[model samples]
Target: MRLSKLFKNAPTTNVTGLCFDSRKVQPGNVYFCLPGMTHDGHEFIKQAVEKGAICIVHSKELKPEEMPVGAIYIRVADTVDAMNQAARIFYSKPSDKMLMYGITGTNGKSTIANVIRNIRNKKEPTGYIGTIAIEYGNVRLQPDLTTPDALFLQEKLSEMVRHGMKACALEVSSHGLAQRRVDGINFDVAIFTNLTYDHLDYHGTMKSYFEAKSLLFSERVKPTGKSILNIDDACFEKLQRISQAPVITYGIEHECDYRAINVQILPKQSKFDLVYQGKTYPVVTNLVATYNVYNLLAAIAALHETDMDLDVILEACKNLPQVDGRLEQIDMGQPFHVIVDFAHTPDGMKKMFQFGRQIAQTHKLISVFGSAGKRDVAKRKVFGELADQYCDYIILTEDDPRDEDPAVIADQIEEGIESSNHVFIEDRYEAIRQAIESANPGDCVLLLGKGDEPYIYRENGRAPYKGDNVIAKECISKYCRHINEAVDDVNEDESFIEE
Candidate 1:
């Protein structure tokens, strides 16, 4: 790649790749001196040059001495934007080559993204990038962030195009949007699940968080794109106002373009009538809960605008794959039902608890959950209150309490927990053990937060920890796994009901 492609008034030199980290700069690569939340890359320009960076793409004016004998400098107003522009050119604008489906919200993003990818994959090659992993063809990568940085994302999208993928389903996080991580994505379909209380630790307020989310609809979406929204969400109207593309609404409560009517929430699945345009189509989802109906509706609506057959999309919804750590069920032949989820926010917790209660019915619902350190502190007490209202017993345990005292975190959560039926357990493994041991026949054990995450963050760093579902299975083996017979096959029999 020529340096002139990155900038108009730059030296006509060849570059191999791009790098933001000074220590990782390779020979013939363009080093972007971007300003970040922690350290400014400008401070490490000398180190980058020493590490074999040939072209310095920086925002600051570097001294003549800083430019080494073999390197060239290209000063820009904003290095982040410059890096994104470089990625678009280098990666051949992959987002423009395929059908891009972008999902953004506080919760349900991973599930929606996965569902879309799986459905589209039935017809042609489709890629997915979200909290769990990134998959396109034979390539599967563990993601560090829900929405990865611009360079990695663009490269992956380009790879997907090379791998014969016709579509890419991506989860657009508020942090990714706020920080300009996904600046040049030409999203063909932008779907908003819902906005709730989350990431306030970074955004500081609900308004700021929503504003960050609004950027995708306003700026990134193509003018002819479709914006599928959950009209039932509180932020729907505001999102609609910001969306520059045509709006397609889906909800159970509101009168929308795609309405899920005559809904039935089952223990293992949900049945509903998808009233779209004017015709009523009977729909069955392998996933449970009412919120999932909205997810299905959003996915179906988005795919419909992509020129897919609505009937095939609806059939695919009937057999949707289980999104990892999102309401994942663990059955070790235990008497009680043990399920795990990534419901960290208050709104997510409330929904998970409601789903637990819905299935538990007369049976006891025991909640094992905790808040993270240095996060939205106000949501901690609110977590207690929601669990107190929905659970028969609550066990507060560690969920990434980095450098913060466990006792103090527990006290803050317990403030809103007026219920006298909860205990503070510092050891997460022991907390899970106690929850399983305390379960009775037909009872439900709910493990919230740290769903599929494989590490525990302490002052030392991210120590390895088995995921919530993994830990729950281990506990069930020790305390509750009485039926240990080896008789197994895939359960192809789906218990679905429709009106």
Candidate 2:
């Protein structure tokens, strides 16, 4: 546990635990001066020194006079990389203790991670770290980042190993990869969901975005890991060429190592024949949407590569419940149906609307959706165009108008809609009410955006907000009770007429 042992080439006279935040520094902790996008870690070096930091690891070159007395000063090319190395060494490289799966893509990362976690069974104590809460054994910790910093990630993995978890699935974001947040972890399996036009603001271009995502399969990852890829994706052909480990491909379009044949896409669920190694296994998933077919195959491929039996995989998937805010259905004795989903991206929105249209038998498909302000403005019009194509009625509303005018965002979306029948409501609650009140018997109301987001970001500050799934259930219960009372009154009038 000596500081010298943790830092191989650098001087480490005094060291304890490593931390990125200055406020969290302790008497013996080594504070890493990481320059973040919003704030500079170098600015807080004095505060860290005041808190009794024993060492300072920084990316910038500094004179000896700037160093605190009795504190070791080490300079690296990048502070993030230095922190990753220090954490990996400090935690004894915990990722090597168990089977670790890294899933990276623009969409479907959380859903795929959850599906794989569910299939692994609760008996083995599987953990998941992603956009949702991080689970270590029975303990759940809320996640502030899609992938936490290297120090926290290593610490969490260490805790998972200490808790005796046999497996862990993590969602690796593009930003996380670019920042070297997951630099030192050894992965047993790497998965790539489909890539699309997303996170262009940070990446600068689509090619750069994909390059950031491809880092998961780079040489820096564990050599023994296996790559599970969706071969049907256009980018997969190129990605397969660069992958360093053994590759396993899955798709419904072509003959892959694992394939889904005899597929039946249903209104409530989907049934498919999972063909692998020249044997076909029947799988019935409780999840809805055709896109889920891809998600399920990715999970199956990951498990199969680990030598999991097809029977166990099928049985586990059959009993798997729906994930929160991902195509969650709400029923409250209402004549119509309601679904809440987190389909913020253009491709995700189109897929959700298509699924809604398919299931809306003898009903009007009413969709309530809005574009996020100040992020990915290019996708706003695409979402609006898709809604117009598949929805009978469109209700445009607020979705995190962060520092931008909600009305302006709505207008941009409106510009893409060819139909003149859409209603624009800036207030999200009013939009939900308008959609619900307009629904009659044999109608389906679809709520999109802010699926499981706990807060709504605004110019002033964020306000506590419940998930759309919760709000949809409450609206359905209130409306159904009113409908029941109205039916009772109508029946009484009928009795008087009979008399």
Candidate 3:
């Protein structure tokens, strides 16, 4: 493609590709000089030029002599915005070619995106891009961000279109939206799960965090498209007010367009009657928890807005696969139960514990968890408090203590605990082993944080740390003995709330 065709301003240069990292620059590729938190891309202009970059798009000013004499240089006010626009045009505006839905919130973005993909994939070819993995037909790759950069995103969407994917579900994070990663992609449906205290290290305030999430419904979703929101969320009113698309509300607490009534959260399943447009449909899913119910409803509402059949949605919801690292069970022919989850935030931990307690019933509830270092220190105390309230025995350990002392992180968490039932273990593997070893028959061991992540990040580097799921199974097989007895189910009288 020619640079003149992609940009409004003319530059008679042949563009072979687009790139931001100079290390990946190739001949005839247009290198975008995007500024970062630490290093400036402008500093790498010489390297990019030396690597045969034919065109350069930059936000920072450079002297005439600094640039390669024959290379094309286009100055823009914001290089990120220019990159997004160029990427969209270069990819032939692929987001407009398919039905695209975006999900945003503090939690449940991955879960909801997975649920929607499962539902849509039953009828037509579908793609999902989120925290866990990116999937469309035979294309599967680990995503670096919940929402990838504009260039990578446009290229992937174009690939999906070529592969005959009918729709795509994207997990839009606050940082992604704030950084203008999804600037030019048009969403056919936008779903807001909920907002809570999280990512304060970057956003700094609850209002700013909410504003970042609000950009999806306000700017990305087409005006004629639909907005599916959880009416029970405190930020629902603000999101609804700012949303340009028509609203479709879903919730279990308050009345809404699609509501889950007569809900039953069991030990391994959730049964609910979905009420929409004066009709009720029974929904039985492998996902257990009130929050999972909300995720299911959000998926159904988003799909229904796209003119999909309600019966098809319900059938697909009933048979949906378990999401990776989301309250996933690890059963190695043992009498007791073990669960692995990615509940890093306070709200996420609280929800995990609520569901744990309900399913535990008369059994002992053992929790193994730790907070991430150098991020959201205030939540450390709250996590300790919640653990104190819920778990029968708490085992505090390391959780990606990047550039911070793991012992200091544990000490901060211990500050809020009034009970002496918990113990601090620096080694995550030892903590998991001890928790699993001490559990008796029918007891539940809950492993929190670091879900399916393959490495433990610390000191500006990552070490080979096996994911919680793999470690849990390995520990169970090593220590726990197989029993002929089965783990007892939860009591019928117990109830769960998304506290």
TM-scores for candidates 1 onward, in order:
0.95, 0.93, 0.95
For model 3, what is the alpha-carbon lDDT of residue 318? Answer: 67
Order of candidate numbers by TM-score, starting with the best: 3, 1, 2
Which is the winner by TM-score between candidate 1 and candidate 2?
Answer: 1
Residue 250 of model 3, lDDT score? 98
Could you tell me the lDDT of residue 1 within candidate 1? 83
How far residue 250's Cα lies from its native spot in candidate 2, in Å, is 0.7
The 10 consecutive residues of candidate 2 with the worst lDDT sum are 490-499
In model 2, the number of clashes is: 0
The better candidate by lDDT, 1 or 2, is 1
- Give the per-residue lDDT of model 1 (tens digit) for 7-33: 797887888999999888888899999
lDDT of 1: 0.87
lDDT of each: 0.87, 0.82, 0.88
User: Quick one: ranking by lDDT, best first?
Assistant: 3, 1, 2
How far residue 91's Cα lies from its native spot in candidate 3, in Å, is 1.9
Better of 2 and 3 by TM-score: 3
Tell me the TM-score of model 1: 0.95
